[model samples]
Target: MRATILMYHMIDTPVTPAEVRFCRTRENFRKDMQLIREAGYHVISLKTLLTAIKNNTHIPDNAIVITFDDGLACNYENALPILQEFGYSASFFVVTSKISGFNDFSWDYGFSCRRMLSTSEIIAMAQAGMDIGSHTVNHVILGKAKTQIAIHEIRDSKAMLEDALGHEIPHFAYPFGSWNPTVRDVVMTAGYTGACSTMPWPNRPDTDPYLLRRSEIKGQDAPWQFRLKLHFATNTMPPITEMRQLTRKFLEKTGVISLRKF
Candidate 1:
């Protein structure tokens, strides 16, 4: 069976004329969940899915791993109930600094309400059956940072998550799919066993655990487009990775300062 892990952001009922990008309106989310259920798929946590993959444990024919990044309040308020309604679970990768629920993240539009889960909220979610993972301290794009900064972001974030969750948070997601050979080494050194990426790659076997590929659910993809992506999405790895390196080199050559994957 092929292991498929799906990434999602917020699941709120989109406010009229949705202003956010990369987030799903509540109606779409409902449709998605309904579609998954109707398709006979089981939505499971990252650990459950990955353990099965790493250990060759068997999974039902239609099992799928569901995940949410950015630790939005909507996750607790909106996404959780839907998953629970369907008896499913998900893994949440939260940026630590924003946990105060004070709107810390300023970059993206969903960030218009970007706030990390409060320690209390995270504890609540954990208690309510959600696996917690780290996005990083400040959501820095590690691949472009200096080596020392990159090391801090990678190592320190993992430690922070372990401290907050009071257990191992061996899984990770680069602040922005920002990955490279050096970044991978730092992540491993930081004690992460498996990490996900924002890159578009296949979820079939023999993937690099340190750079696991994931499908991003941008707000723009229609359900049919999503189906198209799953069937036709680029799953190639070696050449794609080489191309990433070449792009980095070009950025360096031009000092364009690309922080794309991070």
Candidate 2:
């Protein structure tokens, strides 16, 4: 069976005007959960879905996996309650270095700094039935990093998170969705059962479990647009990703963009 993994970030006041595109309001988030139920989709944990796929077991037709990236405080303060209200389980991929730290994982291009989840909050979420996966120790983009550096990021982050939660951290999400063959190999070697990518698509049993695709949920998306996203696989995400990549290349070539501070 095919399954959709929906990606989310902040659910609070936009850190910047541009971020509003991805930051959903609390009311809209609640309604989104309602719509998922109304549409008859069963919200399942990433671990459960991946286990079913690995075993070639049957899953419901309306299966969905809810995931949040960056482990922001807003996710703990806002999104968790709403998910609990719907009795849904989610995987939150956290930047282990940032938990309980004041710094956030800033997008190389966006330069936004937001509060990350605290260590206590992460533990609480795990105890409450949410899966805590590692994003990285420092949210490094493994595609560009040296091989040893990338491996350390993947291995050490998992160790740190498992220490915090007192359980194994067996899932991951690529920082910035920037990955290549090398990055994929390191994640698997580091022991993750599966890892998520921002690339938008539903997954089948044959799909690479290490590079699972996920569709982003935008803040500006209304109910109708959300419905369209669910109904249409990939939809506008591929073209958008392509355009963004092209733009990045152009900016770098023109010396208009450079790597930002970690």
Candidate 3:
């Protein structure tokens, strides 16, 4: 079975210059959902996707999984109804530390100030059938932190989410799509069933469940660009990400940049 995972962030208007990449206008988001339907894709939850991968079962040829990062309130206010309108399920990865407060990303990324989903909103969405996954306690990039720090970020966030929701969080998405061998090992030790990455490609049964490939759906993408990305070419090049990783590593070694800046 082959499946594609789509990654998203804020689903609201771009009020600031930096939010242009992360915030998809409500009208465009609705249109994207419609486009998915018109393209004949079956939207599946993260649990179902992992189950099919584990069991090596046959899934629909056009299967796709939708996911949102940061657990922004707009997901509950703007995205959920559109998802429900089309009968689709999505996975929401929440930053445990940022819930019920303004997202801390604005200072670094130039995003407009916005509040994240409160605990009650998250619970309601989970009860309503959205998968709640962890994006770590403070949105720390695990690949750059010290071993102990990364482990704490991984395990503590999972424990926090499970404790609050009274259920296990079976999935995770590495912050900034940054991870290394050690980070993956810590994620496994933390007991998540699977993790998603920013890598752009569809997953087959043979693909590593821990490093599940995903395509980012940016606000700037047109409907046609979204369609091209699903095909694994012509819109965003995954290899360029690889090059950027190499550059980052080189800069870190030369002391030209700090890993924390990533």
Best by lDDT: 3
lDDT of 2 by residue, 1-262 (tens): 8788888888887777778876989998999899999998888789888898899888886788989988889899999999999999999999988887754456554737777899999999998899999898888888899999899999999999988888889999999898989999999988899999888878888879998988788888878767656655453534556767887888888777877411
Identify the runs in model 1 with alpha carbons over 4 angstroms from their true place: 13-19, 108-113, 229-262
Candidate 2's C-alpha lDDT?
0.85
Question: What is candidate 1's lDDT per residue for 1-262, written digit by digit as tens?
Answer: 4556678877764443333555787777777778777767666667766676678777765566778887888888888888888888888988877886654555443445455568888888888888888887778878888889888877787788788879888888887678788988888888887888877755555667777777776565677655544443432323446767887888877878655542
Better model by TM-score: candidate 1 vs candidate 2: 2
lDDT of 1 at 86: 80
Q: Could you arrange the candidates by lDDT from highest to lowest?
A: 3, 2, 1
Most TM-score-accurate candidate: 3
lDDT of 1 at 101: 61
Report the Cα RMSD per candidate. 10.3, 10.2, 9.9
- Whole-model lDDT, candidate 1? 0.73
lDDT of 1 at 21: 52
What residue pairs are clashing in model 3? none
lDDT of 3 by residue, 1-262 (tens): 7788999998998888888989898999999889888888788888888998899988886788999998899999999999989889999999998989988765687777788999999999989889999998889878899999898888998999899899999999999999999999889888999999887778889988889999888999887678866666222744557868988989999988874796
Q: TM-score per candidate, in order? A: 0.80, 0.87, 0.88
* Stretches of model 2 off by over 4 angstroms after superposition: 107-112, 235-262
